[model samples]
Target chain A: MTPQAQRDILKKHGLKVTAQRLAILDYLITHETHPTAEMIHQDLPMISLATIYNTLERLVAAEIIIVIDSLSDGKRHFDYYGQPHYHIVNTQTNAIIDAENFDVAPLLAAARQASGLNITGFHIEVYGVNPEDAR
Target chain B: MTPQAQRDILKKHGLKVTAQRLAILDYLITHETHPTAEMIHQDLPMISLATIYNTLERLVAAEIIIVIDSLSDGKRHFDYYGQPHYHIVNTQTNAIIDAENFDVAPLLAAARQASGLNITGFHIEVYGVNPEDAR
Candidate 1:
């Protein structure tokens, strides 16, 4: 989103649209892969770690973004899919693939009906060797 | 699970299922709240951290368990919701509530149809203050 758009979102959430917030959001949008707060800090040498922490919390509360736990490195890696989609993680390479196209709706619907259970949502992290590594 | 059951599961996955694994799984099942590795380690003073790490990976690969990222304290928390269910997290107290009954299927299905998007799965973490804390 443009600076103005981000600012509007911040204002809606009662958070100030600071330089740090803009940079972080901009970087996130540019980098399709979801990054942890630490990774975000790695890119911004000037931003304090505390600021990154605050920004993440604020963004999550605003419901402007969604954070998914990444099993990439067994660390607290997050993803910014911005929309609902399945994900693929190369456990060895720590690379992420936005699997927005893979269909899992049928699977979930079947499970829900079979168990007579109501599923709120599903979190799927597919960790496997890379396509090349498998060969 | 019993020690033998754990051992069988581990052996199937080429793991040892040692005393530490048994204790950790036992503690996990006994305590319904999805906990982080740190919380599991807190109860098992005799087990090494490496053991906990190894156990989690092995169990996940064996398809005997599942791990969801807990956003309770913005840490790499793991939830052992062996089966699929929605999760509710009280951010302030770090208490987890198993909200398997909340229905999100209709919402997800509608989302899938709205944009011709195939919804893979969803991770819903309801992070809020506890009842007492809110009061």
Candidate 2:
């Protein structure tokens, strides 16, 4: 997110734009792949895990991003992508790959008719071996 | 899965249907809601967590069920339902609830057109506080 847009969103979510929060958001936006909180803390060495956790929680509350809750490596992983997307999980290694394009129409239709829910939105995780690695 | 069906799926997955495996499958079928390996161990009493884990791994490989990987309480939680469905998460308490029905046609269409790819299926998890609990 741009500096101004990030600030605007933080304000909208009633969150104070702290350096830590901005940094976390910045990491989320610019980071190429999905990462866990521990990974985030590791990347921003100066930041404490607690701060990352707090910032992520605040971000979720503000609806600025979504927490994947994917424990890729026996640890909880978070993906802060503002847009909706699905993840392909490497169960063997617990690696997370961001999926850019996959149409979920047939599956969604089948699920909706079966469930009868007020599904506001959905977070998806597909646990599987990487196609190439499997080969 | 019954003894016969269980044997069939195991054979299909090229797995050996051990007694432990049968027990785990029985546990999943008769159990209500979704239970992880730890929870399954706790419920079965005599079974070890390791056994549960192995059984779950085998079942997933057999394509009999999907691994949820929902760490509702910072611990990996598994949903054994063979059917495709969405989950309602209580972010506050990290509770998992099964949502019976919701349509994803519009959203799927949007995602499909935006990212062109063959979507075999999708799994959804809505990370939010329960509406009733929120009130």
Tell me, per candidate, how large a share of the native contacts it keeps.
0.06, 0.24
Model 2, A20-123: lDDT tens per residue? 88888888888856677888988898988888888887776565676665443455556666666777555566556676565555544544444443334557
Candidate 1 segments exceeding 4 Å error: A78-86, A99-135, B1-3, B41-54, B61-63, B74-135
Best by DockQ: 2
Q: Residue by residue across B31-131, what tens digits does model 1's lDDT show?
A: 77566777778878678888888877766666555566656465555555556665554455556666565565654554444433334444544444433
Q: What would you estimate as the lDDT of candidate 2?
A: 0.66
In order, what are the TM-scores of chain A for the candidates?
0.72, 0.76
**How far is B98's C-alpha from truth in model 1 (Å)?**
5.9
lDDT, residue B40, model 1: 78
> What is the Cα-based lDDT of residue B53 in candidate 2?
84
Q: Each candidate's DockQ score against the native complex?
A: 0.14, 0.27
Task: Give me the runs in candidate 2 sitting further than 4 Å from their true place.
Answer: A70-72, A88-118, A125-135, B84-121, B126-135
Give the CA lDDT, 0 to 100, for residue B44 in model 1.
Answer: 83
Question: Highest TM-score among the candidates is held by which one?
Answer: 2
Q: What is the C-alpha RMSD of each candidate to the true structure, in Å?
A: 6.4, 4.6
